[model samples]
Target chain A: MGLVNSIFATVQFEILRVLTLRRLSVAVIMALFPPTMIFWLQAGGALASPGFIITLFCGMVCLLSLLLWSTSNVYAELEGKSWAFITSRPYGRWSILFGKFLVAFLVSFIISWIALSLCMLVTGDLDFNILNDGKEVPKMQVWLALSGLLFLASMVYAAIFSLLGVLIQRRAMAIAVVFFTVVEVVFAVIPAVVGKFAMSFHMFCLLTHWVGWVPPSAGQDEDANEILQDFLNVYGRQDAWVHLAVIFAMTLLSLSLAAYVICKREYITLEDSQV
Target chain B: MIEFHNVTKLYKTVIGVNDISLKIEPGVYGLLGPNGSGKTTFINLVMGQLRPSMGHLSVFGMDPWQNDGLLNRIGLCPAIQAHYPFISGLKWVAYLTQLRGFSRKQSHQMAAESLAVVGMEYAMNRAMSSYSLGMRQRTVLAQSIAHKPELLILDEPFNGLDPKGRYEMTVFLKSWVKEGRSVILASHILHEVESLNPSLLLVSGGRLLASGSPQQVRSIIANCPNSVRVRCRQTAELAALVTGNFEIKSISINSEAEELEIESMNPLELLKLLPGLAMKNNLLISELRSSDDSLQNIFSMLMLIHRGGMRLPE
Candidate 1:
């Protein structure tokens, strides 16, 4: 009970610390990203397809927000002089990391939702049937499905970035961006069994399975659907539960790994080290 | 209580502390050293912000590395300044107290009282960025003592403090120790640590040179060769008289300043002989200064003793 209370206090402390105007401004910028991109696509006469929009929300808006907030959580404290004050408390180090992770997850989740809503507004896609091909899925149903995907993506990305922050404090942000590009972006899209291991793979699989989202190329290339279908057939289209399970497991694994490393490794400021 | 058994900390290539094995009992212990002498590193090792690269360390009978239970009994006022610009001093202290498992109300009460103790109650509501360095130091001290831990480890607590603030801190530390609690104060200033009258731990070059009561350490320092600089009109005559009467190790004359600098194996006898020699010879002595009292010279002499290059007077 004492430990739980301490953790809650840490969360409250983080809330106070993270509520500055600079951080809020960054959140606003993240919220505005997807809609601005959608507006630009519409002006260019590009198909602002549901797949592109979903990917933008999950990969760009959500991940960008996490990259800003989560990847620098530990680094910021150590770089500043506040590392000792918190790390010296009982369960202080662990609680601080956990609190930052929670705040990062929620902030990214909220920003992603706002981005999705603004994107929908920009496209005037209130019907949300753009993905279901006139099969008349209720607007709220599709909205909830998209919201679920964003929530999962936010959790997974936040946990992963938090681990990166702990593992490599000096270059966490740059390395996280590179990891996102190479692993989540490039590797997740490969039409092979190895792609299933990436968190983004489960996210896209759930998006296609739940929201009936198809690739933007499906309308232009006649065989794009056949290729996607062939790929899914070979991979065996699992249930939505399987994708969700994989994502949740990845999130848990990342968070646990971060906790393990943080508990085992000694983190000190350069000033302290040199002294 | 804390114990280090052959503990050494290596930061990649640089050594922080080397082969330090000691047991610290409950009391006030001043970790004394010059700048960059690994005093902070030793404190960090005790705080568990660092782990020993070799050997082992235990605080309160438990390994301090990731020892959450042990930390509950310890409070650390680190050398690093707090940098939360937006939060008030009260909130900052309260937040840290809350992490000690206190309820919000209790934490605030404790923070308030602790801030009051450190003479920061009036400005506790102001944002930290608006604080003077002394005010921030007071706030940092408040947070460390707010939880009333059994052990309070302060690294350079007197830094950024006015004389009045230093006095208040000394009084507070005295009271804290009178309560039977322990403190480990780390500082490079000898007088600042000396005023506390703490058991001294002198370190140099990442090694513990000596550890004992103030008198014990002072006695060892007293035996080292003492250098005295005298500004006098008759530099040559004074130098000649001092060399003949006292056991002088080295003598150097600065012709421009008309000063005679002398190193003596027995500083007391040399100092006693100075006034009479000047009075008898009508030599005007303007200034007299000793280098042996300084921490740098004391440490150099201790290092020499540790390296078998010098020995204490019999």
Candidate 2:
């Protein structure tokens, strides 16, 4: 019971810290970037397929915001010179890390849901007509399933980025940028077994398995079929359950590692009075 | 309540505290030293903020590093002045109080009470950035004592406070000591530490020069070099009389001013000898002053011993 109160205090403080007006502005801009781009592209007669909506809403909006918020939020206390005051109490490091991870995950989840929902509404893709394997899928079920996907992405990515922040605090920004560019974008699409290691690979896999692929008909032109096949193959490599399990396990591992690091290392803050 | 067995802390090439062993019982004990004299380093070691590089240290019979056993029983009022500018002092203290495992409601009450203890009750609702330096220091003190810790470790607690604040804090600390709590107060200011209590641990060059009552610390360096200026009607005769005395180290005679500046190994002895020597030589000793008994003088004496390889007075 005592430990629980410590963790709760940390969680409450994290919520307060992350929900500031400046951070809210960053979150707002993060959530709107993709949908606004989608609308602008739509004006130029750009494609508005299901694939397009998934990439815009899930890849750009959901994943990027989680990345942006999680990295800074983990190390924010130390940066602001508030770590000593908070950590010097009975509250241990495990409690502090757990609180930060929970806040990052929850905020990312909420922002992803709201932003993706807005995208669907504006793009006229909120149709209550999702059919899977010739079975009528309810509109409410589809909404819930999509919400679950957004939550999953936010949960996993936030944990990973938070772990990064803990492991390499001073270089968190540079390390995160390099990791996302190298692993998520470049290597995740290499069509090799090594590409399976990236989080984006699992994200694509989960999406493909959740929303079954509908191949373009044989009567269709080769160019259209080729585009559809490449898209399907890129995102349809593994079973959805496997992807879900991997994401969940990785989240647990990252959060645990982050807690361990916090507990062990001494944070030598530049707080001495130069007498 | 605290023990350090041959403990030393080194920051790469620089040594913060050297191999030193000592013990302290529960009372208000001052850790006195000038700037860069290992006062902060010793406080950090006791607070579990920095682990000793060699040897062992324990507080309340347990390793202080990451020890949650006495988390509620040890409070630290740090000297650093970092604070969140956006929040009121009440909110900041309350937040830290909650971190001590109190319910939010209980924390609120305790924080207000502690703030009141520091005479910040009226200003608790104001943003900390808008506060004067003394008010901010009080707020930090409130956070440390809000949990009702059994041992309070304060580092340079008198840095920015006015005389009034210092008096209030001194009173509160005396009352606190009277209640059977222990405090390890670190400060470079001599009279400030002296007012808290006569017992102090004198440290210099990362080594323990002396540890006992203030008088004992003073006795250890009794042979420290003293600078004395003597103005006489006949300066040459006084210098001639005092030049070969066993107490005097060096002498400089200024003819135009009719003064003799003398450095002595023992000022007290030289003072006793001066009047008689003047009388014997029939030289009128008009003015005499010894500028080597104050706080800074003691530190200067310690440094001279440290650098000049002079041992402490027996």
Best by TM-score: 1
Poorest lDDT segment (10 consecutive residues) of candidate 1 chain A? A125-134
lDDT of 1 by residue, B230-283 (tens): 999888888888878888889999978999889988666666678888889888
DockQ for all candidate structures vs. native: 0.71, 0.40
DockQ of 1: 0.71
Candidate 2 chain B weakest lDDT stretch, 10 residues:
B216-225
lDDT of 2 by residue, B204-248 (tens): 778876678877765654557777888997988788788766467
Candidate 1 Cα misplacement greater than 4 A, ranges: A47-51, A125-138, A217-224, B255-258, B276-284
lDDT of 1 at A37: 78
TM-score of candidate 2 to 2 decimals: 0.86
lDDT of 2 by residue, A31-83 (tens): 77666766675667563353335444655566666666677644676677666
